[model samples]
Target: MNEQEFLASYDPRAYPAVAVTVDVVALTIREGALHLLLIRRGEPPFAGHWALPGGFVRPDEDLITGARRELAEETGLGGERLHRIHLEQLGSYGDPDRDPRMRIVSVAHLAFAPDLPDAAAGSDADEAGWLPVTALPGRQLAFDHARVIDDGVERARSKLEYTPLATRFLAPEFTITELRAVYETVWGQPLHAGNFHRKVLSVPGFVESTGASTERGGARGGPRAKLYRAGDARLLHPALLRPAREEAVR
Candidate 1:
């Protein structure tokens, strides 16, 4: 068949390509607090609103590559350094009208960084900063982004209890105290220090000692602690579950 004939006979209705987009829930720590990256929309439908940093996936790129591209484009930093940013597929969101433009299937990713660079290099992100997740903005987020962020947070919280993902939020050779802080930050609760320490060590493959110690004690008043690194195990044999809140009497 000739090119013109093939073009005339093509039926998009019979073979539609679902548009794939990538959304990143980039999180970081700032001033001893857990924060999320928020971008201010510059265009319409929900212009001037806040949302997660992301964009449509390119045909030549993988889902993770696309997510990293979006992050780099909006953050202006690149290299294998970004490749180390612990990117994982959170879930897929494909509601018919989730996006006003067209049918867009987004594969959202969750990432944790010790720190983030500056604002978007040259995008419509009027502003980009780490906002305390506990105090997410009340403004309606653009394009169902609020739902995406919620899912990412839950994924982080659950992953930390059984997975070694918490290491992504820490520096190399960190102390147990620092690792526990990551868990407490995401879980939004206080963990018993002694119990937490014991439990973490008991979980084989969770961490390995480096035979090193922090140069100094905690900011407060404690002896210098030892350092450890993530181990070979990807999972915690005995996962840590957070304490459930008690119900109030009617």
Candidate 2:
């Protein structure tokens, strides 16, 4: 072996770099309820515990690619369906002792979808599924996943008023009523229909009409509603905020 070749065979552990991984907080509106995607850890440290879908990053993969790959592994969907997915980094979780195995850093991502099927573990996951956000299991999470999920939820809730993100939870063409429900579900508050309608339409670029209408009205008596799709604006001006409650004075 030549000197050049011998030097390249050094131990990787001698100069170890932190391992990076990507986790996903896949949120969806299911059964008029908000849900999150989670996987059951199969390995030790946190074995059998439910956590967010995630995996270590490969040498050549980018952060977003790793997230989509993890999502596809947890759930059997990919490509444009995944590319069209609205994904953004929620934050990073790297509390020294978060991972029991080794020093690992995780980039948490938040994705909004109209609907999704149950996830079955693939790649490094043991099992995956959609769980109602309100009823997250009590089992201990793998890493700092519980905290990561909390951040993702708050990001979703806060972004609703000033961004067009809420629309990501709806189909391409949806009625104003359908859009309002998305807000109500995420905020967990009931909004006046008249006020909601006026505010939503007033925000330019929040939505634009497709010049189409739903033939079938709501479950009960209601007029046919017009169909609209997402507009050009990424942020909403004059954001539609919910009313604040006043504290009772003694």
Error of 2 at 158 (Å): 1.2
Which ranges in model 1 have alpha carbons more than 4 Å from their true place? Answer: 1-10, 13-18, 245-250
Residue pairs clashing, model 1? none
Using lDDT, give the best candidate's number: 2
Give per-residue CA lDDT, model 1, range 1-250, as digits (tens).
9999999998998965579999999888777778888888877767888888888888799999999998887777799888878888989999989988778899999988887776663466677766789788665688889899989988888888778888888887888988889888888888889988999999999899999888888789689899999899988888776655212211
Tell me the lDDT of candidate 1.
0.84
Q: Residue 237 of model 1: what lDDT?
A: 84
lDDT of 2 by residue, 1-250 (tens): 9998888986777875688999999999999889899988887778888888888899999999999988888878887788888999989888778987888999999999887767888755577788888887565676788889889998998899789989899889999999989998988888889989998889988899999999988789688899999999889997767555212221
Q: Could you tell me the TM-score of candidate 2?
A: 0.90
User: In TM-score terms, which candidate is top?
Assistant: 2
- Angstrom error at residue 184, model 1: 1.0
